[model samples]
Structure formats: structure tokens, C-alpha cells
Target: MSDTLTIALAQINPVVGDVAGNIRLIRDARARAAAAGADLVVFGELCVCGYPPEDLVLKGAFLESCEAAVHDLAEETAEGPAMLVGAPWRVAGKLHNAALLLDHGRVAATRLKHNLPNYGVFDEARVFVAGPAPGPVAFRGIRLGVMVCEDMWYPDVAETLGESGAEILVVLNGSPFEMDKPNLRLEHARARIAETGLPLVYVNQVGGQDELVFDGSSFVLDGQGRPAAGVAPWTDAVEITRWSREPDGWCCEGALAAPVSRLENVYRALVTGLRDYVVKNGFPGVVLGLSGGIDSALCAAIAVDALGPDKVWCVMMPSPYTSADSLEDAALVAGMLGTRLDTISIEPAMAVFGSMLAPVFAGREADITEENLQSRARGLTLMGISNKFGPMVLSTGNKSEMSCGYATLYGDMCGGYAVLKDVYKTTVFALSSWRNHTRPPGCLGPGGAVMPERVIAKPPSAELKPNQTDQDSLPPYDVLDAILDCLIEGEMSVPETCAHGFDEDMVRRVWRMLDRAEYKRRQAPPGVKVSSRAFGRERRYPITNAFTRLI
Candidate 1:
């Protein structure tokens, strides 16, 4: 009998629905762990078909492919260490989120996930059928209990495992990032360990799959409810941790690096998410218009940092009303970042479009409509370049503009991805300053002055019309972002927002704009989500609603 076990946590990035590729990853990870003398190697949830396969699980062919992949993985374990991996299993006409125990080139045992999370970016109920609470599976000599993603969020799952004579509990997960979520996971694991008195190992996937960024801070919690070992966020690493059975319980011998700061972690998540999306989706590079405003500058910086200077292209689509300072600062940023810079003056395109639409707008006084034309012309030019070349167009609009419908639809909103869609305007400024001063971990771009000083200090504007600024239409970004956090993220009622030192009228106005902008947001492209309440799946607001207050 063994009194100690060394387990490997495979913090890997899986491409969605790539069964063959995913199986290869699992095999490679198991081999690495075996070479390190680990007893078993565990991977994130849904390793076979990838996480949140969405509706792809409904297809019979896909399930068959998943089964075939599992068989291949089982076969690959012939020479390596044991494997505990997650996959979708269909039994008796019901689908289950299952964790399989593979040993000696065969399917040793199977455990089904009990919890099916259906809320907030998760639609497990639509794809998966929950299984009864699984008992412990004996691997080698140790009994291990397995839980899928949502199972760790609760206490009973771990307690049931502890009661069933399980020595270690391993959780496979694909949890996404949303501002301090790693800390929340740590707290939850601590609570679970306190309840069960069992060592817990959590392995999570890392990468961006359609607006969701999973920060792979896979960790192990000892019986004392403290973190024993882990990997960093926004990275892929395989770590083998040794745990010994002591008089008290399983004790960890060594842990990994310290946890990253919230800011740094979130920033890495955004960069990782964007980089993976652009590369994995087969885009050669990215192109975006730089307005010298914080949003565009920050997006450009993130693009360059994500994909190197070779992969990022910056175009200055200056219009008639574009300020000299804006033009100079935009050029400065492009030059500093070493991006392939080009100037596509939208004046010519704007004139052509204006003439084409002149008969239609014959009598209507030139309002925001004409200004939006210029924005759309710029959008078309960027898109044309994206089509002529192969780079995906990255939208530079932030959450604040998206929230208040301040962005022109089919104008600045045209893009394959929006990097700053989840970030607030105030936060955009903060990130810009942060990027200018500090280089992100693993960032390939140059460290200093990625964004120009003047770009960070300038007042935000669209430059669509003469003397037009964001403040002309909406509240100052600081005030507006606060109110939006209250209305959209905090879910505060207008009265509650007013209680927080905001004027009632202003609060009502901001709330009204947020309500009216649902249509625009619905049509907006998917972007990396860095906040708790992103406009996409996290918060669902009706496009047409008469009710104003939640109460």
C-alpha cells in the first residue's frame, strides 16, 4: 500500500470539437506525467470534445466521435500512468457529463457529474443530462472522487465524496474569468476542503472560445482548506504535486508560484483570449482604426501585444473634422508600437457616400445621421482592407459606448472581434496607462510607450462631426461608468443609484440609454469579457421593454 501519491494537473488549452487533437493532448500529457513518476494525470472538464460544445453535442456523429476519441485515449494509456479525464457519455438514452477512469489500456470506471449549471454563459441543461452523485473510483491503490465544473461550487458534492471513503477529490473544470473569479474559486475550494477534510485538485482549461476566457489557475487544496499547489492564469502548464497521507490527512510537500494580481491576471486573460481567437480562427492578423482616443489606442496596444507587431495593422481613417492632435498622437502610437501603419483618408469615401445618400436626405437638417455616415464609411474602408488582405477587423468600441448606444451601428461596430467590449471607458483609460508603463507577462511587444502620452490624456471622441465628443451625448465616462456599473452590473435600481450620490435625473437618463441600447448590443460582435456582468450571455436585457424598474 502506498502512503503517498504524486498527481499531475494538466492545465491545457483544448480547441472546441477537435476530438482527435484533444486526445493527442491527453496522451501527451499522460506520458509527461508518467515520465515524472506521477500516479495519475487529470485534465480539465470536457477534454474529449472541449468545453461548452454548445449544440454540437446534439449530433449523433459528434457523440460517436467523442466515444471514438475516448477509446483512443484509453488505448494510449497502455504504457503511461492512469488517467482521469472528462467527456460526454451517453448511457441509456441520456447524456451525462462524465469523468472516466482509464487504467492499463481499458476503461477502468466512470463517474457522472451531478450538477448541471445552466445560467450565465453555461447552457449545460441544453446539452447535458445530469448523472447521480458518483461514488469513488479506485485507481492504483487510492480512491479518487471526480466532480465536473459546477460540482465544486457546492459543498455536498465534496462531502459525499469524503463520506464515501475517498482519499482525494479531483475536479475537472472549464471555469471562465470575470474579475477576481480565481479568488472566488479559491474561497470556494477552501470551504469545500473545510467541509470534507479531503485534499482537492482542480484543473481548468485555458484559452478563449467565443468571448469567454478561462484563466487556468488549476490548484490543489489540502485537508486544512489551504492552497497547496497551482499553475498561473492565462497559461498552459503541467504540474506534478506530491501529497502524502499523514496522521491528519493528505499533506502537500511543495506548491507552485504565487497568485498573480487581479489587474495583471485580467489583462493576461484578455490578451490570451484575443490572441487565441485570432490565431485559432485562422486569421492572418488584425486591423483596426486608431482614433487616438483611449479605446482605440488600448485596443491597438492589446492587438500588438497579443499578436506581434507583424500581425497587427493600424490604419488612420482621418476625416474632415479630425483634429491635428488626434492625427499626430495616432501616428506616434503606430510608430512607437512598430505596427504596419497606413493612412486611408475617409474624406474621399465620405464624399462618395454622402453624394449617394444626398437625394435620400434632401430636406432633413444634417443631424447625427450625416455624422454616422462618416463613421460607417470608415468602417467600410477598414472592412475592405480586411477583405483585400486577410486580417480580421478588430472593433475598438468599449462597453461605455456600447452601453449608451453612443457607437454607430454598421459604423464603428463592424468587426470580427471587439477587444474592449467588456471594459468600461474609465477602465480603458486605466488599462492604457497600465500598458504604457508596464509590460504584460509574456507580452511580445515592446515594453515602453506602447500608447502615446497624448493619446491617454485626450478627451474621448468619435470625430464623426465638428466639435463632437462623447461628453456631448453622454455623461463623463467616470460618472457614466459608475452609473452603468450600478444599472447594468450592480443591478441597482435607479433609486438605489441616486442613493449612491448620483442625481436622480442623471441616473434615469443613463438607465434609459442602457435600456435603449439593447438592440445595438445584441447586434454587436463578441469580445473578451473581463467583467462580472458582460453585455452578452451574462446579462440578458430585452430589446423592447416598457418596465423601467426591477422592483
Candidate 2:
């Protein structure tokens, strides 16, 4: 029997449906763990086939492929650290999210996930049958308990593992990132530890898959539910945590050291999502209209940081209403970021559009329709460039504007990806300031002043009409963002939102806009999700519903 156990947590990112590539990742991690002289290496949930594989897991051939990949990884365990990997297994004509403990070139034991999460971007129950609670696996003379991602969220799995003589709990997670989710993960793990009196090792998948970005802040907790060590979020690395048998039980041997967590968890999440979405989809770069407003400026910084200046192309599509200050600010930001900027005047298109629409709209006052024409022209021009070139168009509308339908559907909403789709206008300013002051490691952009100071200080506007400010159509951003946080994240009712010291009529108006904008949000492209209740998958609402909380 080994006196000490060294387990390596490989917090790896796996591409969805990339069976061979995922296998390569598992093998590579195994080699690293072996080199570290670790006894076992644990990977994230669904590391073999990726998480929330949507409908791909249903296909017999895909499941067979995943099954084959698991066996293949098992075969490589003869002279290396034993592997604990996640994959979909076919059991008695039912598919379950299972974890395989491979040791000595063979499958040692298996545990299926007890809790199959079915809400908020998870449809595991649709494809996988519910797995029952399983006991721990015997490994190197010690009983090791294992559970898949959602199973750790509840008490049944951990409690069952502990009662069955498990010395330690190893949790595999496909947990995606939302604002402050790392803290929440620790809180949940601590609760489980308290219930079972067993120390826990939580390992999570990293990288962006579609709109979901899994920020890997994997950690280990002592039996007293205290955090022993933590891996920094939004990073990929293999960490070794040693445990030794004590008279009371197994205890962590030495302190685990992780990188210091910064204030940019959400910002790093956005950057990761944008980078993966572009890279996985095989897009060479991204293109966005830089309006010199806070929203666009923040998006520009994120883009450059995510994909570097060479890959991000900035364009200023100015109209007759475009301010000189805005143009200067846009140029300043482009210069600071070292991104190529081109000026394409929409003045000619607006003049032609006005002439063409004038005869048919002779009796009507020049209203929002004229303003919309300029926005649509810019959208068209951006789309044309996207088609001619290969870069995806990154739409810059923030959560506040989208929540109230302040953005036009075919106009400002035209893009392949919505960069700030989940970001509120208020958070945008904070993130931009953070980027200018601090450059986190692995960012492709420069450290100081990725966003120009003037860009952050200026008032935000669309420049679609003369003397236009966002507040003209909606409430002040601070107020509007507060209302949105209540209605969306808090899921508060209209009266409840009003109780937050908001004006009743304003709350009613904002509610109506949010309800009406459902159709636009449905049409918008997938963006990085950082907030708890982002518009797309996290919060789903019927576009045609007549039921409104506002009365």
C-alpha cells in the first residue's frame, strides 16, 4: 500500500465532437502526470466527447466512437499515471455520463453521474438516462469516490460515496462560467465536504464551446471544508495535490499553490469565448464597427486581446451625424491597439437612400425610419466586408440596449457574433478601465491603454441621428442596468423591480421593451456569456407571448 497519494488534476479544454483530438489531450495529460510521479490524474466531465454534446451523443456511431476512445486511453495506462476520465457509456441500451477509472492498461471501475442537469443550456436528461448512486472504487489500496459534474451539486452522490468507505471525493465538472461562479463553486464544494466529512477535489473543463466558456478554477478542499489550493480561472495547466494517510483519515500533504485570481474573471471569460468561437469555427479574424462609444471601444479591446491586432480589423462607418470627436476617438483607440482602421463614409449611401425613400414618404415627418436607414446602411456595409473577406462581424450591442430593443434588428444586430450580448453597459465601462490599467497574462493585446482614455470618458451614442444619445430613447444606463439586473438576473416581477426604488412607469416601459425585443434577441448571433442570466440560452422567453408582468 502506498503511504502517500499524489493526484494530478488536468483541467483541460476539449472541443465538442472532436473524438481523436480529445484522445490526444487525455494521453498528453497522462504523460505529464506520469512525469510528475503522480499516482492518478483526473480530467473534467465529458473530456472524451465534450460537454452538452447536444444531439451528437444520440448517434450510435458517435457513442461507439466515444466508447472506443475511452478504451484507447485505458490502453495507454500501463506505464503512466492512472486516468479518471469522463465519457458517455452505453449500459443496457441506455446512455449515461460515466467516469472510468483506468489503471494498469485496463478499466478498473466506473461511476455514472447521478444528477443529469437539464436546465439552462443543459439537455443531458434528453439524451442520457439517470444513473444511480455508486460506491467508491478501490485504487492503490485506498477507496476513491468519483462523481460527474452535476452529481456534486447535490448531496446524494457525495454522501453515498462517503458511506461506502470512500477516503476522498473526486468531482468532475463541465461547469460553465458566469459572473462570480468560481466563488459559487467553492461554496458548493464546501457544503458537500461538510455533509460527508471527506475532502474534495473539483476539476473543471476549460475553454469556450459555442457560447459557453468554462472558466477552469479547479481547487482542493480539506475535510474541514477549507480551501487548500486553487488553480486560477481561465487557464490550462496540470496541478499536483498530494495526500497522505493520517490517523483520522487522509489529509492534504503540502499546500497547493495556484495563481492569484484577479478582478477580470468575467472579462477573461468574454475573451475566452470570443477566441474559441472564432478559432473553433475556423474564422481567420473578426471585424467590427468602432463607433468610439464605450460599448464599441470595449468590444474592440476584447477583440484585439482575444485574437490579437492582426486578426481584428476595425472600421469606422461614419454617417452625416457622426461626431468629429467620435471619429477622433475611434482613430485614437485603433492607434493604441495597433489595429488597422479604415474609414468608410455612409454619407453617400444615406443621401441616395433619402432620395429614394423621399417620394414614397412625402407626407410623413422625418422620424426614426430615417435614422434606421443609416444604421442599416452600416450593417450592410459591414456584412459586405464580412462576405468579401472571411472575418466574422462582431456586433457591439450591449445587454442594456438589447434588453430594451434599443437596437435595430436588421441594422445594428447584423453580425456573426454578438461580443457584448451578455455584458451590461455599466460593466462595459469597468472592464475597459481594467484592461487599460492591467493586462492579464495570455492576452494578445498590449498592457497599457488598449482602450484610449477619451473613448472611456465620452458619452455613448449610436450616431444614427443628430444630437442622439442613448438616454434619449431609454433611461440613464446606471438606472437601466440596475433595472435589467433585477428583471433578468434577479428574475424579479415588475412590481418587485419597482420596489427597488424605481419609477413604476419606467419599470413598466422597460419591461415592455424587454418583452418586445425577444424576437430581435432570438435572431442575434451567439456571444460570450459572463452574467448569470444572459439573454440567449440562460434566459429563454417566448417572443410571441402576450403575457406581460407590466400592468
Candidate 3:
């Protein structure tokens, strides 16, 4: 029987459906683990073909490729440390999310995921069938309880493994990042440790996958539910932990990363999501309209931080209603970030459109149609630059603007990706202030304030018309965000929302707006999913419906 063991937790970023690239990542991690003298290397769920492969796992050829890659990886384990990796496997004519143990140039054992998640950002039940409750896999004289991502969430699996004589619990996860998710993960892990009286190890994937961003806050918990070791969030890491069999149970020893602040984590999520989406999709750089407003300014800062200032191109498209303060702020922001700034006036386009449409409306007064034309002109200007320079246009609409349909359809919403799509306006102000005071690790932007303080302090405006503030069309951001949280995140009814000290009439109005804007949200670009109930796959609502009235 072995008295000592070394397990290397490999936190890696894998692209979905890229079998060869994923294999290379796995092999590189294995080589590093072997050099560190590890007995086993543990990787996240679906490391072979990436996590949440969506419907890609349904393809027979993709599954065959992943299976072949696993075999090839197993052959490499003959002379080095064994590996425990996750991949989709076809067993008995049914596909399962299986964790395979590779040793001695062969596949030793496999454990299928028992609980398939079907809520929030996950739909694993649609693609993978649930396996029977797993016991433990024997490795180097230690019976290790192996549970896939969702399996650790329930008690039945852990209890079964503990009763079956499992020594340690290892969980392979691809859990996406939401606010307060790290603490929630720890709570669940501690619960399992309490039930089993066995130490647990968690390994999670890190990277941007479509709207989802996986924060790899992998950690280890002792038998007494105390933190033994951990890796930081928002980055890929390979941490080696030492374990020795003590009299009571197995103990772990390693360094613990400092806890990250909520604001810092949210900012990092935005940067990481934007970086991977632009880089993984093979875009040279990003071009965004840098309005003087808080939303566009924050989007510019995030883009500059994600891709270096050199790769970020900012343009200021001023209209007749554009304030001089906005022009000055935009220029100062560009200078501070060291990004190229260009000026393009949309006055000519507005004039041309007005003249072209004069025949249809001989005596019609100016209204929202004219305001929308200004936004569309600016959108066209940005898209034209994008086409000429091969850069993706970034939209700068936040959740608050998107929620009440306060944004123009093709105007501000014209972008390949929306960096602040899921972020509320109030949170945008908070993040801007936080970034100014502190610069997080792995950022390419300047250390000091990226924008003038007045930018955040000023009232937000679209600048479509004169002396117009966001409040002219919508409620105050603080109130609007709170009401939105209740309706969207809490899924509270009108009366329930009003119970939170909100006026009944206002709550009903907000609810109506929220329901009416579903179609606009349907056409919006995908952004990072940081909230619990993001608007995409996580929260789906039918556009044409009478459910709102009934509620």
C-alpha cells in the first residue's frame, strides 16, 4: 500500500470541437505534471473535446475522433504518471460523460457521470445519459471516488462512494462563472467532505465558451472541511498537491491563493470572455464606438485590457447633439489607453437620409425615427471601418438599456460581440470605478485610471438628442437595476416584486417592458454570462405570448 501521493490539478482552457488542439493541451499538461513528479494528473470535464460541446457530441465522427485521441493519450502514459481525464464516450450504444483512467499505456477504468445538469447554463441531460451510482476507482493502492461535474452536487453519489470505501473524492468540473459561484462551490465541496469524512479535490476548466466563461477556481478540502489548497480564478494553472495517509484519514498540503474581490472577479470575467472570443475566433483586433457615455467608455477599457491598446481601435462618431464634454472625455480616454482614435461625423449620412425620406413624409415632425437614423448612421460608420480593417465591432449596450429596449436596434446594437450585454448599468459604474483605482493581474492596459473620474460621475446619455439623459426615458439606474433583479433573476411576479418596497404601478410597468423587449434581445449579440439568469440559453422566454398579462 502507498503511503504518499502527488496529484497535479491541471486547469486548462480548451476550445470546443478542436480535438487536435485539445489533445496537445492535455499532452503538454501531462508532460509538465510528470516533470513535477506527480503520481496522477487530473483534468477538467470534457478536456478532450472541451466542455458543453452542445450538440457536437451527437456527431458519430466527432465522438470517434475523441475516442481515438484518448487512446493515443493513454499510450503516452505508459512511461509517465497516469492521467484522469473527462471525455464523451459511447458505451453500449449510449453516449455518456465518462472519466477515464489512463495507465500502463491502456484504459484502466471508466466512471460515468450520474447526475446530468438540466438547469441554468447547463443542458447535459439532453446530450448525455445518466450512469448508475459509481463506487471508487483503485489507483496506486488508493480507492479514489471519481465524480463528474454535476455528480458532486447531490449527496447520493458521495454517500454511496463513502459507504463503498472510497478514500478520496475527485470531481471533474466545467462549471461556468456566476457572481458568488466560488463560495457556492466550496460550500458544496465541504458538504460532501462532511458527509464522507474524506478529502476532496476539484478541477475546473477556464476559458470563454460562447456566452459562458468558466472560472477555474479549483481547490482542495481536507476531511474536516477546511481548505487545503487552491488555484486563483480567471486563469489557467497547474498546481501540485502532496498527500500523505495519516492515522485519521488522508491529508493534503499546498498553497492557497488569496481570495479575489467581487468587482475584480467580474472585471476579469469580462476581460477573459472578450479575449478568448476575439482570439479563439481569429479576429485581428476590435473596433468600438467610443462615446463619452459610461457604457461605451467601459467597453473601450475592457477591450483595451483584453487585447492590448495597439489591437484596440476606438472611433468617435459625433453628431449635432454630441456634447463637447463627451468629445473631450473620449479623446482623453483614448490617450490614456494609448489606442488609436479616429473622428467620423455622421451629419452627412443623417442629412442624406432625411433628404431621401422627405418625399414619404412631407410635413411629418421630427421624432424617434430621426433619432434612430443618427444611431444607424453611426453603426454604419463603425461597420464600414470594421469591414475595411478586418476587425470585429464591439457593441456597448448594457443589460439595463437592453432590458427596457432603451437602445436602438441596429444603432448601438451592431457588433460582433457585446462586452456589457449581461452587465447592469449600476454594475457598469461600479466596475469603472473599481478599474480606475486598481488594475488586476494579466491586464495589458495602463495601471492608473483609464478614464476621467467625471465620466463615471456624469449622468449617462445616448446623446441622440439635446440635453437628453437616460433618466428622460427610463427610471433611475439604482431603482431600475433593483426591479430588474427581482423580475429577471428572482423570477418574481408583479406583486412579489412590489413586496420589496417597490411601488406596485412601477413594478407592473417594468414587468411589461421586460416582457415587451424579448424580440429585441433575441436579435442581440452574445455577451459574457456573469449573472445567474443571463438572457440567452439560461433564461428563455417566448417573444409572442400573453403570459405577462396572466402573471
Candidate 4:
């Protein structure tokens, strides 16, 4: 029997449906692990075809490709350290999220995922059937309990594995990032360790997948529920851990990363999400309307941080309502970021639109329609630039503006991706201020301030009209964000929300606006999801509902 073992946790980013590319990633990680003298290398869940492949796993061809890739990878184990990787495996004509153990150049054993998550950005139940409770997989004279992502959440699987004589519990995860998710993951892992009385190893994938951003905060916990080792969050890493068979149980020793602040995590999530979306989808770069407003300024900074200044193209599409302070702020932001900024006057287009629509409306007063025209004109200018160039337009509206319908549809909302779609206005201000003082690790932007101090301190405005500010239409951001958190994330009713020391009428008003803006959000571009209750797949509300009225 082996007295000691070395295991390498592979925290990698894989693109969904890219089987061959994923194989290369696995091979690369295995090679690094072999160099580190590891006995076995473990990767995250569904690393063969990427996690949450959604409906891509349903296709017979895709499953066959994944299986072929797994077998091919299994052959590589003939000469190097064995590998434990996750893939979509089909057994007895039923598909399962399986973890395959590759040893001696062949597929040695497979453990299917017992618990399929069906809530909150996860819908595995609809794709694959859950497998029976899994036992330990024997490797190098030791029994290792292997669990898929959701399997570790509950106790039944860990209990079964422990009772079946598993020595170490290993979990393969594709858990996405939320502000509170890291703590929750550690809590669950510690709980499992407490129940099984066995050391645990967690390996999670890092990268952006659609609206989801997986923070690879992979970690290890000893039998006593103490942290033995950890991989840093928001980046790919291959960490090797040494495990020894102690008298009581197995103990692990490795490096532990420092804790990341909540604001840093949120900012990193945005940067990772934007970087992956643009790179994976084959966009050359990003172009955003750099208004003097906080939302747009923050978006510009995030874009530069994600794709360097050379890749980010900013345009100042000024209109008659644009103020001198706004013009100066936009120019200063662009200069500090070292990005290419161009000024395009939308006045000509607005005048042309007004002349074109004058015959249809002879005596109609200039209301929001005219204001919307300015936004549309700006949107058109940006889109035209995108079409001529290969850069994608980035929408800069935050969750608060989107929730209250304070944003114009297809105007400022026109973009292939929204960087701040899930972020609140208060969070936006906080992130901008934080970025000015500190630059998170792995960021491509400069270490100094990304924008002028006045940009953050100034009042946020769309500048659609003279002396216009965001508060002209919406409540104070602090109040609005708190009420939004209660209604959306907390799922509290009007009475419950108002009980949080808010006016009942204002709470009801906010509810109505949130409900009414569903269609707009539905049409909005996908952005990073840092909150527990993001707008897209996580939180879905009916466009034509009377729930708000009844409330």
C-alpha cells in the first residue's frame, strides 16, 4: 500500500463544445502535473466539453466527440501520471455527468454524478439523468471518493462514500462566481469533511461562460476541517498538493492563497467575463460610447482592463445636451487609459431624424421621443463604427438603471455585451472608486487611477437634456439599490420591502418599474453575473404579469 501521494489540481478555462481544444487543455495540465511528480491529476467537472454545456450535450455527435476525446486522453496515461477528468459519459443508453479515471493508458473506472443541480443557473436535470450513489475509486493502493459538482452539496453521497471506505473525497466543480459563493463553497466542503472525517480536494474551472463567470477558488481541507491548501480565485492555476497517510487519516500540505476582498472579486468577475466573451466569440476588440457618466466611464475602464488599451476603442458621440464637463471627463478618461478616442457629433443625425419625422408630427411637442432620438442617433453611430470595424459595442447601463427603465432601449443599451448589466449603481460607484486606488491581480490596465476622481464624485447622468441627472427620473441610488436587493435578491414582497424602512408607495413604485422593465431586460445584452439574483437566467419574470398590480 502507498504511504504517500501527490495530487495536482488543474484549474483551467475551457470553451463549451470545443472537445479537441479541451483535450489539449487536459493534456497540458497533465504534462505539468507529471513534471511536478504527481501521482494523479484532477480537473474540474465536464472539463472535456466544458461545464454547463447546456443543450450541447444532448446532441449525439457532441457526446461522441467528448467520449472520443476522453479515450484519446486515456491513452496518454500509459506513460505519465494517471488522470481523473470529468466528461459527459453514456452508459446503458443513458447519459451521465461522469468522472473518468485514466490509468495504465486505458479507462480504468468511471463515477457518475449522483446529484444534478436544477436551480439558479443550473439545469442539469433537464440534460442528464442522475447516477446512483457512488463509492470510492481505487487508485495507487488508495480509495478516493469522487463526486461531481452538485454531488458534494448534499450529505448522502459523501456519507455513502465514507461508509464504503473512501479515504479522500475529491470534488470536480464548475461553480460560477457570486459575491458570497466562495464562503458557501468552503462551508459545504468543510461540512462534507466534517461528516466523512476525510480530507477533501476541490478543483474548479475558471473563465467566463456566457453570463456566468467561474472563479477558480479551488481548495483543500484536511480531516479536521482546516484549510490545507488553496488556488487563487479568478485565474487558472495548477497547484500540486502532497498528501500523507497519517495515523488518524490523510493530511494535506500545500500553499494557501490570501483572501480576496469582495469588491476585488466583483471587479475581477467583470474583467474575466468581458475578456472571455470577446475572445471566445472572435471579436477583435470593443468600442463603447464614453459618456462622462459613471456607468460609461466604468465600462470603459473595465474594457481597457479586459482587453488592453490598444484593443479598446472609445468614441465621444456628443449631442447638443452634452456638457463641457462631460466632454472633458470623457477625454481625460480616454487619455488616462491610453485608448483611441474619436469624437463623432450626433447632431447631424438628430436634425435629419427630426426633419424626416416633422411631416408626420406637425404640432407635437418634443417629449421623450426626441430624447430617445438622440440616444438612437448615438447608438447608430456606435453600431456603424462596429460594422466598419470588427469591434463589438459595449453597453454601459447598470442593473439599477435597467431595473427602473431609466435607460433607453437600443439607445445606450445597444451593445454586444453589457459589462455592468448585473451590477447596481451603488456597486458601480464603489467599483470605480476601488479601481482608482487598487488594481486587482492579472488586470491588463495601468496600476494608477483609471479615471479622474471627479468622474466618480460627479452626479451620474445620461445627459439627454440640459442639466439632466439620473436622480431626475429615479430615486437616490443608495435607497434604490437597497430596495432592489430586497425585492429581487431577497424576493421580499412590498410590505416586507417597505418594512426595511422604505416608503410603501416608493417600494410599490419600484416593484412596478421592475416588473414593467422585464421586456427591455429580456432584449438587453448578456453581462457578467456577480449577484445571486442576476437578471437573465437566474431570475426570470413574466413580461405580461399582474403580480406587481396585485401587490
lDDT of each: 0.86, 0.87, 0.93, 0.93
Provide the TM-score for each candidate, comma-separated: 0.98, 0.98, 0.99, 0.99
Per-candidate clash tally: 0, 0, 0, 0
Q: Of 1 and 4, which scores higher on TM-score?
A: 4
Candidate 1 lDDT over 1-551, as tens digits, reads 57888889998889888888888888788778888898788899998888878888889999999998888778877876788888989889898889998878988898888989988888888888888877888877778878888998988788888899888888999899889688899888888888888888999998889899998889888888777887877777889998788888778765676767767876787799899899889999999998777787788888888999899999988988999988888888888889988988988987888799899889879888889888898899899999999999999998998999988899999999998899998888777777788897888789787877777787777887788777889998889999999988789988889999999999998888889889999999999988888988788988888786543
- Report the alpha-carbon TM-score of model 1 versus the true structure: 0.98
Candidate 2 lDDT tens digits, 500-542: 9999999988988999889989998889888888888778999
TM-score of model number 3 = 0.99
Checking candidate 2 for backbone clashes, the offending pairs are: none
